[model samples]
Target: MKLFQYDNFPQVTGSRVSLRQILETDIKDLIEISFYDAIRAETVQQAAEMQSKINQDYLDGNSIHWGIVDNANHNIVGTCGYYRGLDKGEGELGCVLLSQYYGQGYMTEGMSLAIDFGLHTLGLKRIWAATGQQNGPAIKLLERLNFVKTADLNDDEIEYELQK
Candidate 1:
């Protein structure tokens, strides 16, 4: 089935994590995750804005954003999305994880599922990710996923892409 065809976003499960739509109930968890995201949000208002934008973008036919849940405990650990907010017509991937869950390979596996869905389901030609220059783990994850350095988005941001 095509992504975003259901009332909720498509559920993509892996051995360690599952990707599904970030529900209203996930707001509390998202606030915690915001501490580790590029944009820091300490208040419910700020966090809710973040979550609202994600959902609103999807409803506007932008992209698929999923909450990364730890399969073992069913806890929301992070968020991941492909096409970089494009309408399934472009190729960019973005993700954020709780600081506590970092280095556990959850993002790697979760993003893999996203990339696979883009390739097999969306027929994307390539997928790219732009991350902060200081985000070593994110950079490493992109490299590990076989994404090549593409460009320098800014002094602090770098881009990488994986071609199909």
Candidate 2:
């Protein structure tokens, strides 16, 4: 498929979370997430840079990112996406959830929707993710989703993949 062929960001709905395009209104929540020490101790400037990269990646067809919003409160809880890979047929899966939401299955549902969109809607043959070696929760989530470890990116990072 041609890059950037998608005219609109897809809104994927799961039971507990909805994946939609990140809006300007989500900046505050994003900043909050960025400031969390466990996530990334980002300054305002750093947070803005991260937001800009997300926008630019979407515009350039390099990735598609979505804000993970709760269905009940409609609050942005985190973000996830499919980052285009060097191979056109594949993309990298990425996500972040608020610390409070960890182990609650919210991210698992959100990521399942994103992976479905990548494989079914986007026609991607493979979707992959990389997590820190010590990120046990992330590794467990990926494993539960049937992603297989494929590489050791470094001492701190490991890569996993799921093929359609």
Clashing pairs in 1: none
lDDT of 2 by residue, 1-164 (tens): 23755567779998889999878667766775652213463566667667777777677777788889999999888888876582477888888888778777889889999988887887787789999999999999999999999999866899999844
lDDT of 1 by residue, 1-164 (tens): 23345565679889988999887788877886653236778887788887787676677666778889989999988988863535546667888898888888998999999999888876777688898889888889999998888898877899998855
Candidate 2 Cα errors over 4 Å, as ranges: 32-41
CA lDDT scores, all candidates in order: 0.79, 0.80
- Lowest lDDT 10-residue stretch of candidate 1: 1-10
Candidate 2 has its poorest 10 consecutive residues by lDDT at 34-43
lDDT of 2: 0.80
